[model samples]
Target: MKEKQIKQFEEALAQKLYKLDTEKHARAIGEAAYIDEETFISPDFFLYARCLVVVQGKEFYEYVV
Candidate 1:
C-alpha cells in the first residue's frame, strides 16, 4: 500500500481498537504487537479486522484470540 493508504489504515484501526474495552482483545492485540512488531505495529491488520467488525459486531470478540 502507499504511504497515504497505510496512514489511513492505521488511523482507522486505532479508532476501532480504541473503542474496544474488553481485556481479552486488548491483551491479544498487545501480545501480537510484541510478537511481530512490524505487522502489528502497522495498521495493515486493520483492513482485515475492520471487515470482521463490520460483519460480526459483538461476535468479533470470539475471533480475537
Candidate 2:
C-alpha cells in the first residue's frame, strides 16, 4: 500500500476503535505472516504476527469468540 493509503487506513482504524466500550472490547490476532521474498512458501509460516482484528460484524465476532 502507498504511504498515503496506509496513513488513511490507520486513521480510520483509530476512529473506529475510539467508539468502543473498554469494558466490552479487546484486541486479538487476526491474520499474520511475513511477506518477504524469502518466504515464497506461504502466509502461515510466520507466527505471532498479529493482524489486529476488531470485534465487529456478526460473522467475524462469532469467528473470534
Candidate 3:
C-alpha cells in the first residue's frame, strides 16, 4: 500500500488496540497487542504475515506486515 494509506491504517489499528479490552480477548499466548509499520502480534494467533480483512456492511482492510 501507499505510505499515506499505510499510515492511516496504522493509526486506526492503534486506536482499536488502545480501546480493546485485553482481558476479554486474552488467551494463553500473551497480553496487549503489538504493531509497527508492519505485522500485528496477537496473543492467541501469534504472527500474521498478511493484512486482515473484515467484512461488515462494507469491506474493511487492515494492513499488517
Candidate 4:
C-alpha cells in the first residue's frame, strides 16, 4: 500500500478501536468469561480482550456485538 493508503487504514483502524471500547462490550466479555462467583477479571484483561476482538475484523466484531 502507498503511504497515503497506509495512513488511511491506520485512521480507520483507530476509529474502529475507539468504537469497541464500550461498556456494553466490556460487560459482555466479563459475562462470557464468568465461571462462577469466584471468577475474577482485571481491567487490563478486558482491554486486551477488546483489542483481540477488534483485530478479528469487521465481520467478527459485528457478529460479537
Per-residue alpha-carbon lDDT of model 3 for 1-65, expressed as tens digits? 99999999889766655433343323323344444436455643532211122222123332211
Q: How does candidate 1 fare on TM-score?
A: 0.35
Q: Between which residue pairs do clashes occur in model 4?
A: none
lDDT of each: 0.53, 0.41, 0.41, 0.74
Candidate 2 TM-score, C-alpha based: 0.36
Candidate 4 lDDT tens digits, 1-65: 99999999889877776787766676677555534446675767777887898889789988876
Against the true structure, whose lDDT is highest?
4
After superposing candidate 2 on the true structure, give the runs of residues whose Cα lies further than 4 Å from its correct spot.
Answer: 21-65
Instruction: Supply every candidate's count of residue pairs whose N, Cα or C atoms clash at under 3 angstroms.
Output: 0, 0, 1, 0
Model 4 ranges off by over 4 Å: 31-44
* TM-score per model over all chains: 0.35, 0.36, 0.34, 0.60
Query: Residue 33 deviation, candidate 1, in Å?
Result: 19
lDDT tens digits, residue span 19-58, model 2: 4322233222223223345544233322212133343554
Q: In model 1, which runs have C-alpha deviations exceeding 4 angstroms?
A: 22-65
Error of 4 at 43 (Å): 5.9
Model 1, range 1-58, lDDT digits (tens) per residue? 9999999988976676665534434345444432443444434554454455645754
Candidate 4 local distance difference test against the native: 0.74
Q: Score residue 50 of candidate 1 by CA lDDT.
A: 45
Return whichever of 1 and 3 wins on TM-score.
Answer: 1
